[model samples]
Target chain A: MIVAFLCQNCAQGAANTAGVQRMRYSDEIHIVRVPCAGRAGAREILHAFNNGAEAVAVIGCCFGACHFSDANLITLRRVKIVKKFLVEMGYSTDCVTMYTSRAAEGDTIVGDFEDILERKYDPETPPCPGGAK
Target chain B: MVRLSVVQLRGCERCAWDLLTLAKNSSVEFVSHPLIDGGSGSDNDADFVVITGYARKSDEARLRELLSRGKKLILYGTCPYTGGIFGLMNQKGADVVPVTEYLSPVASVLGCAPSPDELLSVIEGQSAQRQPLCSECERHFTDEEFDKIIRVPDWSNREKCFNNLGLACSGVLSARCAQRCIDFDTPCRGCVGMVDDPPGRMIGYFGSLAVNLQVDTVATDCATDRLGDRPDEITRSLVDVVGTFFRFHLASHFKFPGRNPSTGDELADIMVARPIEEAPQIAATIYGRYGISVALNLIEAYEAAAGIQVSDETRELRSELRAAQDGLLTALDQHDIEALEGVIDKIRTIGGNEVLSNVYFGGFKRPVKSAKNGFDTYCVGPLEIKAVHARSEDGCSRVSFSTDEQGVIREWSCELRSA
Candidate 1:
């Protein structure tokens, strides 16, 4: 399953519009609401994986558009660091990412949800050990 | 009197040597200690027990039994506190079990080797609260230096904080020590256990930097540094995060194997065996593996098991620091004094001034001494050499000799007899 944490100001608004327009994203992806995408942080995101989530999405406001003053930038940097760790460990770096959305961009958030759900972890690669504890 | 018994399960006996000063303490009665000649038997019956070394899977049953004995258990040295250098092997799924998984220590002493004073203070019921070493650090640095992270700057003694100078100091993650390394102008390698939530803190710290670091930055920062890719090159130094941040806590910090380029190789050994160039750093942090040491590259391991194949100067001397291991191993193991000095000469020719004794002798523990006149006594178990000095009645002639236990000197000590 995929766990997506959506920021209330932007990404959540996009997700709500996607729902209003009846846009279909993967049923496996569950969205959690947060004040800012940075609040999802590495620990909370890793916690989702420990509980059987295959991938995690931290959908925040566009870089300069954060309601909480550069909160999305913090999330972006953390996701990059996490990806570096993942690739170094032989796991798929594509398993997690930070995406930015605008209130009117319903299709973009739904597309991100679908793209993340498609990046299945390969058993042939350094296995994830079923996500970090 | 506090009846104390000490057992060294699996560590460098440096910490045991650290306790030698306590031998003369009147209030503490040492029931058993390896260095204290009369010590023998398990340390089970003492009123207080001090155990050093990281416990192995085989040692778990014995450790639990000691814990069941109901005596106060004090963890002495960083090995028992956070698995020491061996803790790095846990990334390979090695069975380095932390005693905390089974029992909590009554009191804990921290340091790669705790000083005699710190150990004494803890033993006397002055348990220090756990705090990050940063709170006590007085050095200062600006955030701009992270752009060019240097290792051991010439000005490290400038009376500022190590991290403030972009020295890659892990003092922030570590618990406090005597600051011995810092005193000598060396960076704190973080041999002590980490403060709470070290990994989370590391993630935050590294994230905040947004450092666009690459291998060349090390050389760019300091061009005249050692040329060869010696194992102790930039990779082994504090320039990298694993050696800096997770130096002692990788076992508890990460939940994965250390394979990079994903060889998927599995051996009964705790560390994966690889050729010199592809050697693994402690974790997936790099391509290869080092054995039971923080810096023992696969070079010596391959040389010892197979014929000495480091004949290629290009490959062998890449990390010039390792230029002496196999030679020293052969000379010391066979008691060849000339060959040993020969290796020392080679290191000196490479401009290594002073006796460079950094080579890790694989399974052999290096001899260490702190006690006065302990030269021969302390080395007994590791490299048994006895030294004798003699002088003539006229004080005109003198001779000194050293050999393994079986050697005896008689005529060498005889006076010239007016001949």
Candidate 2:
């Protein structure tokens, strides 16, 4: 399965650290680093889903530990609202998920992605053109 | 035929960008002039003057004088309506030299700018129209096959309440624009100025109604910054302050605790004394509470009513609320006082007050007493505050109260009016 991981700040830094250490991770997992998870608006998420990615996850800093103060909380609330919208648009809830991880939780992040990939997902629902998912 | 003249005021390329798009679709003739050129001295011949950006009071006066020569006008973009970002500096006190300095809400002030769509609509003799496309919806208003859509009132009209206008139509920058801004994490400065008919009256009239009705909360969206943080002078700082005030002009002028540009009304005193009124309605509609309740009830009914079907979740929430209400009524009828008390305690835990009180009411109060008359002043007790409001453009709040045997409210110390 094609999996995309949108990582913000701490998560992104951790990915870099993993990369520097030459830590082995699944080649299928693509990591995209962003300034803050909150900056990833609903449009961006929907855009990814519309494109080729079979599943997507937003990795923000752990609640209250965001580098930009309340940025993580804002993103969390926004993701909830966007999830509702996505559900109404007929996308499976399983396809989109939010993951909070500290910089040290690199192994956990990769492990969670592996577990999520094993779940059954419907391929029949056509993706929206230019939407994230 | 609406004769039109387009002037580039003080905005980014958005207004001009949209105007070019408009020029392609309509019969509008382009009256080209240098950006910030004001006018080419041939303004009197134009029928409709379309200003493309925010303008300072000086620019505003020039524009208004030019437009006033028997011609209609449209201000394009947030610059015209709320003066956009450029108006933010108005709060800092920068432009014109003044005798007595003050800040003012410019919603009603002449030469205010508006968005291109707004200007275009005005030029066409139709009221300013908001953006037709909802980003959430792929189709624009013109593309929608449906007819007879429910249209909301304009934001600038005084008749509509801020709450009743819902999340989209009322307040600043058009409801849709406001909601979009919020979605994008931006605050609306109210560039639209309550777009309904019969432009809204600022604090003076609304405040009078509030005092007369003894309403507690005005569902206040407007405020004045007398807090030392406010810039000392406004007239001189017109250039920077113009656009920001334009955005919040409606809230600023109509705000109960604000200053009027002309008469100098103090809105805070009205805010302070509101708690003193018996049965003061904290939340009121159109200066009273009925408007909000009616609007909310209507929305609920619309959602349930056959014509307007609400989401399953909303319907479920409504039914749940009804069931809860029924249960409470039955318990009350059965004399389940303990159960009722428990429920009340639960509500209190959630921060619901038994009866709202203006516990923290009073702010600073300034009287009209002159300095020549020594500051000594005395009055009776339990004074019945007759009316509290500000005069047009003067920006001072007027509190008229009847004295009990001795004047009570006036008993407080007075200071000399500075020249």
Candidate 3:
């Protein structure tokens, strides 16, 4: 299943907006709210993948717009680190993605989810094991 | 009361002063016999040992004797942690000793001469954590003020960041030196020591920051001197970005030319003689730790230095193919036959016949049929392809090719579409 980490202030608001707008997105996506995307460490993202997330996405505030002042930059760095780790571990680098969204862009969140679903459903790729302890 | 003894193996005794100051201010008793009489500290019966500077062959015996005493070891300077500036003697065949060669220290305070406060903190049984220079100066300026200064600052504005003034501050990668030099309206020279992550993470952070601030060219130009003579224009450009990134910590982190496996002089000669070949390897070893971005940047830098050039035609073709791929993705998402056909025509013009065949075979799960006239295309899901132009030398030829919805090519003919 696709797992998404949404920043509470920005990304989570967009996720809520998408739900309110009744935007159609894949049911395979599971959203996890975080205090800020910066709070999501590399280890935590890797842990989600290790625990059976077929794909992972981190949604945070746009550049230069982080509520915590440069915290999103930390999140961006963490995402890059996790993506590198995933590649080294023989996983598809496309398995993880980071996106920036404003609270008003519900359509963008749904579109990003759709993109994740498309990547996850590649027929050539085998399913990743889920429920990793 | 903890009994502490300070040992100066070789080189300058700068950090010894900090240790002494720490002893005078704290409860730790200093064993002063070694300093007064040139005697070894083994006779002092100290509870803790603080060793500074690079140990030479002659100092090794004394170091071994000190290690044998089994006192808790704390290497208190950059010399012990990374062999320091004197460690450069390793290039000239001098035997320099790093503390790692003998015993593992309980804690290491890594600085040219660590701050007095850091030494005191370690002596007080506290962890001496390194802070980036930015964190130290945050109290003096707010986030908005800092961002404004970094993003857009007056060139003559001396009280703000020195980096904006075209100075090689290295404040981002260095430990907080209390902004002493900056307070005097002078730039920091990074004498304090590198941040905990050193060149890798520090490079990425600062490189991105420089890019954001649009001062990358100036920042890079300032860092080029550290790269030595072998650096080409590409290497010069990146030296500021990556060379500056790992300047202080290069010796400590990666195995370089003048290091143990190879002598510094020998490595220096090789780099000077065969820079294009050897420089990439050195750059790779240094930037590889940071991640793919730095590695890719190094590759581009090396390619540029080596005079490897990609033709504009090829570059244009690559971008066209990329755009076509994006178009194909959009077409698939929207199930638009017209959009798909437009992308197919663009791909055909760009000689993307192989890519089209692969996309059809892999993406659409179709058995593509190729012929002299045209490609018999197949469709899955919603849209259906009637025909696609294959490679042709003479020009457009009318050819009929068809495929069923099940991705089975019914009739095939390979032909080019006329302009």
Pick the DockQ winner: 1
B-chain TM-score for every candidate: 0.55, 0.33, 0.46
In terms of lDDT, the poorest run of 10 residues in model 2 chain B is B356-365
Better of 1 and 3 by lDDT: 1
Q: What is the DockQ of candidate 3?
A: 0.03
Give the local distance difference test score of model 3: 0.48
Cα lDDT, model 2, residue B385: 25
Q: Given candidate 1, what's the lDDT at residue B177? A: 72
Q: How accurate is candidate 2 locally (lDDT)?
A: 0.34
- Model 2 residue runs over 4 Å out of place are A1-8, A20-28, A50-54, A119-133, B1-419
Provide per-model DockQ scores. 0.21, 0.01, 0.03
Q: List, residue by residue over B1-419, the lDDT tens digit for candidate 2.
A: 34456666553433443344344444665554332233463555566565555555556466545544655554454455444433333323222211011222211212122234555555555644345223332212221111111122222232333222221222232434312322211123344443432112221111112211211111111110001111112111111111222233422221111121211212121112112221111211111112112222322322222133333333333233233334334444454545544533332221112111111011001111211222122110122322222111101111222222211111111111111
Alpha-carbon runs more than 4 Å astray in model 3: A1-133, B22-26, B39-44, B56-64, B87-97, B129-131, B138-155, B159-168, B178-180, B185-196, B209-247, B259-419
- What Cα-based lDDT does every candidate model obtain? 0.52, 0.34, 0.48
As a TM-score, model 3 comes out at: 0.38
Error of 1 at B272 (Å): 8.3
State how far residue B17 of model 2 sits from its true place (Å): 27
